[model samples]
Target: MPQTIQGFSRLNKEEKIDWLTSNFLSDSQNATSILKQYWNSDAKLQQLHDEFIENTVTNYYLPLGIAPNFVINNKTFAIPMTIEESSVVAAASKAAKFWMSRGGFKAEILGTQKIGQVHFTYTGDAQKLSSFFELTKSILLNDLKTLTASMEKRGGGITSIELINKNDQLANYFQLHVTFETLDAMGANFINSCLEQLAESWQREYNNYPVFSENNAEMVVIMSILSNYVPQCVVRAEVCCAVSELTEADGIDPEVFATKFVQAVRIAEVEPYRAVTHNKGIMNGIDAVVLATGNDFRAVEAGAHAYAARNGSYSSLTHATIENGIFRFWIEIPLALGTVGGLTKLHPLVKLNLEILGNPSAPQLMEIIAVAGLAQNFGALKSLTTTGIQKGHMKMHLMNMLNQLDATDTEKSKAIHFFKSNKVTHSAVDSFIKNLRQN
Candidate 1:
């Protein structure tokens, strides 16, 4: 039975913690001590972290790791990844190293157009709204000039704005569909600002239209916001090599591997059940990189999934093909990333990750992230088609299992050695450790 407190956000960190612990926890002092223990040693830096979001709380940390040896466009890079999941960084690193000798990855930006919308309900004739939109479009642009000035100087601004009718889907529904080029920034704030301005200007200017008086139908503005479905803001990353060069050190035939890889991608393309898991593996890599670089992974995930199902069925984001004795594996994904705004400039690790990446522009970051996804998918597919996925994955997960079981260092080392040749299952490890303690 926690009670609400007014001005909770205005409270200091210790006061906020005191309120939370007193209301929610059985031991207020212990909980407060626990929260303070996670605070940064530097008071100024800790204050910065405290102000990053709403009410201040102790920081929740994830491993900030680098997957080394990513060779893209003939330049080598050690990509940074921030995630809690085991084996993701390892898998990506392995894939990068594997493709490095085969001329590495090649990436290209396909497009860089972000989207936003102004939704409204117009009870009047659709044709009239369209005509009114055409007439008032310039005014919308003029109203956005102050907002778009800085973005325009950086070579990014509103690309297009169109009035779209959705009467069949939702009665009296319409949208001011807008597109933009945000350049090196994700531009959600910028895009939403412009859309809100357009909405405000349109509502004011519509009163003067002849149709407004004739029809007596008002245009009621609903909301103005940026869309996460940025299909046009896409990039492609691929690795191509001779089928003979695609062989593993384990003596697996190159042609056999290529055939299985291509078939695996085809199955994902045709089967929705498999496609979800398949695309998730790809996101394992994409999300890690996106998170590391301080971009919106949720937005990237939503847009990528939407693009995957663009053809009426959810399919694989990564594709593999064999043509003219060459094996090609690639992925094309829409990523609205920013290198200069949001957490990119705020979060300490994000700044380091970007610096580690040689400070790529938005398009360049898109290429890197897309390559990471493609590399990740390749690692997963290669494992699935050969050694089986759980073999390596469970091996990587053994330490976590050991920690959960509260094994001592000696026990953990022994378990690691034992599981190296034995199966890694909860029961098996539990039995092994129990027997070891008994002995």
Candidate 2:
């Protein structure tokens, strides 16, 4: 049985590790060795990692890979990706190279608005609440000037604030829906702080209203926080080339391939079952770049999926079309990214990724992320229409399975050669290994 320990965070790093291993680990010494093995050789860097969060433990590492030959807006970039998935970088690189000769990807920022909300319950007359909001809206906006000054200096701050009535759905519920422009930072903390300040100002000013005096009812604020669903903070990435440009080495007609590709995208657009996986393939590229650049993949995922269902049905984030003797594939997604705050300035690899990406501004980063997604979709659709997804994906996945079995160098070499001509399946590899061992 384990016991809860108080003041656990007060313990130093080594002591905390000692207590954890002694109590929870079956082999305490081995566990300690394993944990220590991941520590950075540079003491200063290790200390920095330790202080990044509470209850410091050994560092965990993921492979950082570069997907090269991404040409966007006449400029070339080698996008960095941090992911555990084996084929994402390879697929993105293949797509980038495929488009490099076909005029590459073109990306643009559609908008750059983030949202926050202050929820409160008011039992007063709806008419009175609306009147009060109209009267006090400027007060709420003006009250936050001090908070917005720094953001304003950077050409971003509060964009708009509106009162929304939601009593029809939930009893006595109303909200202050606010919009913001955070130029380079992710702005979670900044948006949250401003919302809290607005709520405080509202509560203070509500008592002076004649409506509140007449009704003797208080406007109770439930909470104030930033929203991750930033539909307006959108970026669009597209690639287009002549239909005949989509030539095939496998002898399939280019026109047929282009038609199949468009149909595949349409299927994903209408069918939710395929759309989920289809969108996931897009995220495989988007999330990889997002993670590599040290932005929040979870938030990007939430906003993007919400936008996909903006038409009331979950659908593909990427769309494809072939018309007027040309084929075009593109994606429009809401991505809130930063180039200068949070982990961007802290993590070494994040800084390196930013440098490798030409240190794009928030909007530029959005364009990059969106292009990554579109490129990934193009790659997937190309394979899906022609060779089928599994043939290449399983081939890329071969190394992982081989690693799991801990095959020797000689065995791995043999397995790679064998799988080149034959299909890769776990049973086939297992039998191959078994026969190799027996012989």
Candidate 3:
């Protein structure tokens, strides 16, 4: 029998951590040990540690919110997200619930392969160098093969190779695109290592001296580098949901609502002004999960935005439509993420999170991420479609106001009620609190 997942809203912070440990971490003692490595007993130290964890170490506790009622590929999954924005979780949960009312989200993943690039540059004859590399392609490939023999044994190896001319104001440079089939791993480290070895061999073969710079390197006034951009793999997901679930207590057709929602996203995708806010919504969920799992959120953000504009047209990362009285959603992005090595091994909480995800392989992880991106996009669209996005958000913002006011439970309740009933104001909250006290 499978274990039950506890609802996040019901548990406090500490309880949530404990539950995560119980469900994900195989050994409580190990989890505690890992926690102790970073956490201190002193209050001030603990606070500093928390900041460090958020800023430097694994920032898993950003904002562990919930997206409930997700039925993907006919299986129910309650997504626990760590995002700072207010509307994303609520909107995703609402979308999931709406979909469940219909038949739930249906999704499928294409494959689990990422592209890595090997760029070559020199002042020498470009045509000659290309001819040299081509003549020695078999030998160079054999070298790469030897370097990645272990990976090849694991059913992964360099699948394709290409060369491109990147022209610029300074000079034209040659770029070598090395495509690899990385199975169950991010393959960054592996790809870089193999490329560096190949570069050394290329340097020996050609007198131009092939230099492998992770970043742009200064080579006697000319610079050449290898990067992580080769469009080798693609991941796709689709969701179809019903409209009635989107209806409030009052009767409203969610399919019509979804049309309006798509219009809002279209505005965001086209207009530069709305595009900023639109991308912000997508990042709200992406950064949170990236932070939670000890991954580099900044890189992911950069890559996502760059990909959004990859087609030379500013566009939304998602597409939504209404078909057969149901709302359909789709998303495609070049998400080059890793599951093994790097911080995934360094951070204990990330390990715990991955374990809770049931040790998903790289393909499975990519599939989950693709789904998350779609779910997040759906959520933003839903919010922009109805309720104006601020009403629900401001209600949650009341928590901060309550904290600032230092109001008790009853006082907070009264203040919120009074604020909502009337025009919200500081004076109004104070007046309501005073009235409550008098009563």
Give each model's whole-structure lDDT. 0.91, 0.92, 0.64
* TM-score of decoy 2: 0.97
Instruction: Please provide, for model 2 over 319-407, each residue's C-alpha lDDT reduced to its tens digit, 9 standing for 90 to 100.
Output: 88888998988899999999988889998989999999999999999999999999888888888888888889989999988888888
lDDT of 2 at 412: 92
- Model 3: residues with Cα > 4 Å off, grouped in runs: 1-38, 41-61, 168-170, 208-230, 241-251, 323-326, 416-439
In candidate 3, position 378 carries an lDDT of 68
After TM-score superposition, the amount by which residue 274's alpha carbon in candidate 3 deviates from its true location, in angstroms, is 1.8
What ranking of all candidate models by TM-score puts the best one first?
2, 1, 3
Q: Scored by Cα lDDT, where does model 3 land?
A: 0.64
Question: Mind giving the per-residue lDDT tens digits that candidate 1 earns over 1-439?
Answer: 9989999888888888989999999999899889888989998888888878888788878898899999999999999998899899999999999999989999999999999999999888788788888888888898899999998998889999989899999999999999999999999888888888898999998887776888798889999999999889999999999999987734688889889889999999899999999999999999999999999999999999999999898998988889999888888899999998899999898999999999999999999999999988999999999989988999999999999999999999999989989999888988999999999
The Cα error of candidate 2 at residue 223, in Å, is 0.7
* lDDT comparing candidate 1 with the true structure: 0.91
TM-score of 1: 0.97
Please give the distance, in angstroms, between residue 287's alpha carbon in candidate 2 and its true position after superposition.
Answer: 0.7
Clashing pairs in 2: none
Worst 10 residues of 2 by lDDT: 245-254
